[model samples]
Target chain A: MERTRAPFAALREALHAAEERTRLPVARLLLLVLLLSVPLWPMVDSRWLRILVLVGIFVVLGLGLNIVVGYAGLLDLGFVAFFATGAYTYAILASPASPALQADLNWWLAIPVVLALGAAVGVMLGLFVLPLRGDYLAIVTLGFGEIIRILLLNVRGLTNGAQGLFNIPRPELGGWVLRSLDQWYWLLVLSAFLIATAVGRMRASRMGRAWEAIREDEDVAAGMGVNTVKYKLMAFAMGASIGSFGGLVFAGFFQFVNPSSFTLAVSINVLSIVVIGGMGSTPGVLFGALILIGLPEVMQFSETERLLSVINPAVPFADTTDWGRQVASARFIVFGVLLVAVMALRPEGLFPARRPQARLPERHESTA
Target chain B: MFWFDQFVNGLTVGSVYALIALGYTLVYGILQMINFAHGEIFMIGAFAGWAVLLLLGGSAIAGPMLIVALLAAMIAAALASSFSAVVIERVAYRRLRNAPRLAPLISAIGVSIALQNVALKLTGGRDRVYPRVFPTGEVGLGDFSVGYIQAFLIGSSVVMMVGLIVFIQRTRTGRAMRAVSEDRATASLMGVDVDRTIVTTFIVGAALAGVAGVLQGLWIPNIRGTMGFLPGIKAFTAAVVGGIGSVPGAMAGGYFLGLSETVGRELLNELPGVSLPNEWRDVIAFSLLVIVLIVRPTGIFGERVSKRA
Candidate 1:
């Protein structure tokens, strides 16, 4: 009877350990369901796919920015510069004007090139501003962004100037054109998931620890044997590389590259996503991107507009001549208000970092 | 001939930048947070002045009434700027005092965006033309020529700067401001109203931006919702360049940035193979900011503050 009892107790302990091992994976699976459930809803509109794509792009951007602003604690006001680099890189490389390259370069090819270029630019910029920190760093980055934009605007031969590059072909996988919004939506989801997973792994690795150390106290981090300069450069390059990847995807999906698409406003929007979503957490970035991107898109429906019109009748305007301007202009106000409210009330974010749950010990009687 | 004209043009713009920088420096000296909305205040001031001029000149008030309108606009700008500063402090900053340092910075950005949108809504998303209040006549000083508008902007900015210097150095409140800036807790113990002092710092800074706005309207002759963004950024850069938290530093930074922009453009034109068009002038200005930040983080005159402080 004692032998039988001992075997039962060991079996129960083994079962408990297995459950604990699978807990996080189960949680992740649930989160995946929640994310995918939107598309599966019976009442969900096809237009939502487009919004999801945008959310994916913003998530990519937010994750990249999280490394710089969240992990490194650097306020980078000019992050859009990397986005521009990627977009332009794709534009120039894929465009027919290039001697060897056709107007429609393969998506796979353009992405790596864009990322490499972005990383190079990031490294260069990091070197340039090595001496500056805090507000000074912010201002320099802002200037750098403007410089990139101005160059894009003025360098007519390369960028096609303010008119921007258009008619670039959409991405194709072995003639399987991702032409539909739904296909693109799925593509973005897959890519975002992969990137998020990789980012999660990276965050738990040695590099992530270095970033945390640097953020908390740079001098102390350096003293603790963390290679401060190397880690900072790594953060910048990795962040820029991720941002460029998003840009490549964006350019490929739209089949157009314009200077206006990558602006200080774009940088601000991404920054707002990181801040509102929660700075350092992976899930926080995803949530932030969804809210910032999805909310605005959802608000753009005709019914929603009509409903808002009832609240402020004067807003819709009697003349429909400039309806586009009215619609476009409303976005800035909404974005601004959201940014302010989020920063004021919940600066930490909606899904702040949660403490890991402890395993409960089995109840046992002490041997006399 | 055109070369000399551009130099004068640069000086005039630089002087305006100097005026705006003063406000940034003053606020930073006390709060250590950059007031991102200060530029929007400048834009609002210009728009207000434009609106006032349009109303007064178009209606019963004419001729000398225009001067009265200008004075009214200046006073209105000061009040408006001060009010904005106070409100920003109350709503956005006060709560974040004990939070992470980045908290206020983010809040400031939010305020900036909100104010920009407000300005856009107020202006109906269009540029408002300022009434031709300042005479466009240019006077010759040797080979260089300065417009009447330029003179007015420079002169008024200098006078305002002098008045501010005197106020800070001479008055009890100004002394209190200095004391608070030097040490907030100690100043509070010494009977300084720290909150009030911070609010006052914002007001003074905002008022200067307002004056600069009026001057900008007079000189530029057009105002838009986003007109303040670049100028505001440049002014902040100027404040940093001269030395953030130093009153005189703002003036020096503004002038330096302005002069550098002007000279850089001139130099670019003179380069054997390179020539940047006039419309792309902002490129030079922004590049200068990057270069300055890289070379001198403390700026030319700015002293580095202890991180704890």
Candidate 2:
């Protein structure tokens, strides 16, 4: 494992030759997949499953954003709008607030509706933002996101305002209720796997190459007869669709929908996962999701405080001290600092795509 | 008369927004970067003013001394914010000068979050009442009146804007700043000291924001760590509506945004069968942003650049 470069290279070469000789790529891939999924099954009763579901939600979100920002090179700061939209759609349909709709709607029936609505909204937003470029586009998207949240907050008739929609009906398959943490975890695992695979395949397709070209240089891509506007819109809609699907899962797991949950911070967090994970890599997004979700959970302050006091008798601060609360509150400061440090040090993120690039430039400088 | 009162009110608030938007405009004009932590500097200004008020034996002083004390607090606030702005420029933005657009933007966001949290820690997330140093009396003709603080704001903001116009149009340093904005590389090559110009741009912008913060203390008087967030966004919106990277555009945008938000709310309320909530007022500013981007694209005073990405 600690071999020098020469040995490691020789071993890697031998392994590749052996792999080619054996033609066991599929077998090895399956084995790797099995190894990943098998461990999740045991975490059924544990809180780890809850964390896994959280990571899965982000995975779907990161995958969604990867298409727009990573592949198409659009900087969208309003991604949470789509996520919130998807969640609210399901929440409104299933919650008791809309009894007429909920009494007849099943989870299976609601799925496609959410997906379609998400895609439609994405496209609608896409149309509005299509003409803009770079930071101007970013600000417009941010404004749109705030507008959605404010609209949600004000349109008390549909969303129940800030009180939020609770008692959202859980998904079911005939007689089986998908209510347990493990059940939700499995559902998310399947969803994440499906999304990652579909997106991964899509990344290598002709459409993906066109998107990559646009990302590299939209003008050049357009010069080459690539329909930049259409491809960018498609990327937006696709990203929105996937992101909203994630929102659907989040609503299902929590059995609630709130405007507060879908803030600009959430969008930034998802963006962080994508950017920090290596923007275009599917596996990187998952790994980022795991780190962001699991790391915070592992650093649960009260438990850490207890461990600290146990390890050191001279510890003056008690568990009930304001110091613990400060640390909890200070996590965001840590997160903010980390975001800056990472963007500065490694803009490529933890794992990078083929090209670790900067943001696309805007056309106009007269108005930012 | 009622409309007159509303008009006066809009102008007063618009003056405040203009004060805030000037910061956005100045920085954007020179650096082409949105200083996201600017709002936090505005907050810092308020806090610094509060500290000054305390240091001057409290806000309970009398008459001429009160005026002198208030002015001192405002100057202190301006200095504090200017210092903070320079620090943010050097530490967060300087290193990533050539990095992609996302890096600086994300770094700005990070600084914003960190500064806000630091403020929250300092204040324990409570809203502190800023002292009413300025006289609270209203003065004017019958049925057309303005508060003492509002008058002060309107008067001071105009003076500052006029003073700024003079500085930029007449001064050598201001000419250098304009030169940098026009072409940074060329300006640097031709003895502009681009870094100094950028730093000056930040200081001047931040100082206005600090003064705006003091006015916020005078106007609203209830200050909190998160107070800057909404106003910052609105000012940014104003900057855009005026035309981002345009000095006069930002000024015009701020006042226009302020008037529209106030009068727009009034107009919305008057519409038959429309019972829009008060929370909708905040959305007006953001909505204005979207509409401007869509319909105008170049904003009110912005010069249209015909290019595509």
Candidate 3:
């Protein structure tokens, strides 16, 4: 075990050293991120802005998932269920499409409803798999995700079947009509910032330590007087609440809700983010979203055709559409392979979450 | 009579699921890992069977000659699936044997994705028609008629299940498999040839899946790359509902799940104003899984479920 970790320790040291070199404090880092993105706001077109919004949303999702899988050591394969629930909840109660509501609710008003729904569902999931751990939990959660999607797809009158809900009323902030993509983009960015801050602080809290202990070993965690079940449920509720924010923003941005948008692949993609970025690393989640979501946008069909066509004039543009579709389909394969490779090689992820070195063993012994 | 017909229909589908579920049980017994890619392996078997038919003068030829061709296709499929299962174990699962239990499962998901994509690529995302090698005709009256394909599926699955039990109880390789599953290190120490036994467990499990795949194609008359996924999940659900590592439990669970599905749909259809769309039939499996988990986490037959899969 030590041998397996030797390389990672060295890498961690190198990373720490690099951080020391660029030793910007938390306030500076936040300001730097905000300042750097200022140029991108005006330069990017709506298409690019849409991609950026998705990236931010994913980052938020990754962070939320990081709390569960990373800090709490749970493998949630059905997380998209909660995301779907949040989005669907928003669409149902806050849109004209829902005949039951008959009135489109305000975005601010809908946010709490969505959070409460997400939290309730999260608790149900936590309770459902209270006895299950690891792979069993994963598969059951996967079933849960599928069940939600199947329900959404089949509930004809309510969900509008496969055609999906469209033309959702734009979100309003105290009577200001928030219609532009830029406004929604900022909403997401702001949400991402808020969620990340909450998650970051949660990671350092007493409850957070209990989660870490549970993640390391449930038996030991329980032995230490930690209410493992309650904390586990709390983690789920927290992650769900954060993810619901993403969903609410998602519906607002597109003014659309579709069952097609939420799938196992989405859950897996967020899992990959939590994984590839760095399990418990807040910044890692952001980086994970950038690579997983942003990289794919770059590789989308249109981009692929232009690049390929430029390289070879004889290449027919029309035929490249097939190539594009194949590539799009192939992304899951790549992600899957990447997941296997990454988990096997570096389970700690690209940016291993930094724990306080001096405090590690004392916590372990205390828990013990 | 409507209920009886649905019951019969459920039994036919149930047998195939039982065959697939057996694969899950066998692998779970030995390695204690959920072979997520097992379904794709089943799909591969179907495709291999289809390829054999195409090679052996296509579907245009029929009669006694077609039976011989079909037997050959079944063998090809079993062999193909067995081989693929071994490869998956070696490439994706071997290294993670002692790692966290979740590692292998995640890796298996990767293999599942890769294999499913391979199938999609090969079939060009379309369902491949199984050459109608056998004359499929109903052999009953009054809407209670059973088709030859359906009979063959139930009969063959039963035969296979019985054969597996006999092999396990009576054969040396099977004994070694049981020994390894009981305790791998001890089995290795006791000269059980642990690695080979594990490989054999995979082969046997995958062979069953392959046969199920062949039966499915023959029964449904269409094979697709993605076909393994739904059945695979259903079979696994069957395994879990029955008690994951229990062979008999998987069989019972499969039948129960299958019956519930058809019967539930039948019941829903019969109830006025509560007729759900046909697509909601898929919900039966998911709901049953949740119900079983909530009611009996260890499954009906399982003595105990490990904290992990």
Candidate 4:
């Protein structure tokens, strides 16, 4: 029995070491390959490109939300306010509303402006909710989100009200207008990748640890010389800025800005992505976005009566009225069910963070 | 005269707000989680009431029969809303009890969306008009006029509020509910059926919301798939403003919110060179929530519970 135990122990130790070695680097390489290969694919269709752009945008939003939710442990139900701020910032600055730019401002200029506006809004929102925590914080943020949406709706002269701001010019670089959906796809992919990497690094840094500490126990974190309030605000601002960045890209890509676009639904979608992706994990956020966005697009056939008819002979797939409404509404139900399932079965997500290894017990202790 | 009109309008609206706020406060007091689906439950009640009115269209039912139908509508709404609440607790929240606080919260949002969509599908995404079952006669006193529908709304809301208060203070079930809200494990140890109490709390709150929904349909004369959204949100704001987890606080908060919205709109319109449109009423309500949170996170009457260890 002792001889057999030695081999089993050796094998187990070897497997554990192998897993520890390959886990992060392999994941990084795979992500790198996926990112690099997407741009080189020659047969990428417009529809596929559009899907990619959406995935990238949501990935960024999810990452930003992860900062507040996963790191700071703040339940911000109104994260879309930052997204709106970014989109509106780009719209008002680049569109005809601004006499100085007049649709002539470079995309680069608008990007920074959007980011700044997003950060500014994030800081303001953070300051506003500095004293509140938990459920109260959630409601207050929710109210703020509605307030922003209402402002956008009511301030017709500035926002063009429900009609929305349109005719947004595409990103131009040195007289080259990148108007194709594929070009925008590449831009979004690059931006999402950069933001994800930065967020991942941030999670590993001092501030990230502070956030985790605060999340686990606020009083303990504060007692341990950590500035709880500062770290919390940092998480909020960073998340908000990232969300706004995604919004800026989304606005430019769609060439439209409207109050309807930045609803509570958008905020919920981003939150779900983070939750499904596994809180506090960067690659998890990307994976979550891809699944949430890409799966529906790929499975668009499942929604069609013709496809369903072929699959099932007994059930009639025809006579389904309001296909558009059903399609729109189905997303929420599917997301909700998935969220519940994930929380029940795998709260840690598909790929959980690796825990630090502990040394084997000393021989004396084992023998005793 | 206009000021008096605005004040009366505010008071009437405030009463409705108090009704809705009671539901939020009651649920929050028990679970310590803001039932995001509470608003959706309120929406369900409105739709249920609308359905009842539709069924009784053109019927020559006298006073007692009309009261029966209204009671039936309230019962239907309460049943539907309670079922929804229970289902949400079982499907989305039960398993999440030991998980992070955010887990239940996010799940609640998911449930909220799911319920809203289900409601949208059921209601066909259109405004379902309530059949004009109630008379629109007006009662006048010293140049002041109150419509029958308005009077019904205010009177019924006040009665409901009083009944709810009495139930909480006097009933054994209500005592169990209060105990559970105070401390779940202790309440259970003390022989209170925590789960049963929770279900009962939800049923009671939903019944009140159901009544409010019917009254709203009669008073406002329109019911849409999304009609409950604004009212639900306003009521929640009222609950918070009054003092979440406090029964009396909810009543006070609801009336305050209703009054604020009504008076703010009227006063804004009357202000020279500062005309505010009616749609901005929601903005004002939400802003009030933000300002309240900034000033007093525990709300006006809510006592702070120590953070969970």
Question: Which predicted model would earn the best DockQ?
Answer: 4
lDDT of 1 by residue, A105-189 (tens): 6777777788788899889888887667777888788888888898888888888888888766678778777788767777777
After superposing candidate 4 on the true structure, give the runs of residues whose Cα lies further than 4 Å from its correct spot: A1-26, A35-44, A97-103, A296-305, A313-329, A348-368, B57-64, B269-272, B305-309
Q: How high is the lDDT of residue A164 in model 3?
A: 79
Tens digits of per-residue lDDT, candidate 1, B263-282, equal: 77788788898888875677
Sort every candidate by lDDT, greatest first: 3, 2, 1, 4
Kindly indicate the candidate among 1 and 2 with the higher lDDT: 2
Relative to the real complex, the DockQ score for model 1 comes to 0.51
| Recovered fraction of real interface contacts per model | 0.42, 0.46, 0.47, 0.45
**In model 2, what are the clashing residue pairs, if there are any?**
none
Each candidate's interface RMSD? 2.6, 2.3, 2.7, 2.4
**Candidate 2 chain A: 10-residue stretch with minimal lDDT:** A359-368
**Chain B TM per candidate, please?**
0.93, 0.96, 0.95, 0.92
Which 10-residue window of candidate 4 chain B scores lowest in summed lDDT?
A: B53-62
- Evaluate residue A91 in candidate 3 and report its C-alpha lDDT on the 0 to 100 scale: 83
Writing each residue's lDDT as its tens digit, candidate 2 over B27-135 gives 8777677788888888889889888887777768668889888899889999999999999898888888887556677778878888888888778889888776677
User: Can you tell me the DockQ of model 4?
Assistant: 0.53
Cα lDDT, all candidates: 0.78, 0.80, 0.80, 0.76
lDDT of 2 by residue, A1-368 (tens): 23336976666555545655666645446535763575456534356666777887988999999999888878898999999978888888888865234554567677788789888998899898777776567778888888899988877788898888888888988887888776677677777777877887778777898899987778899999999878888898889999999988888888888789988887888877888777787777877777766566655647765664455533455544445544655666777777678777876777877642222334211121
Docking class of 2: medium
Which of the predicted structures, 1 or 4, would earn the higher TM-score when compared with the native? 1
**Candidate 2 overall Cα lDDT vs. reference?**
0.80
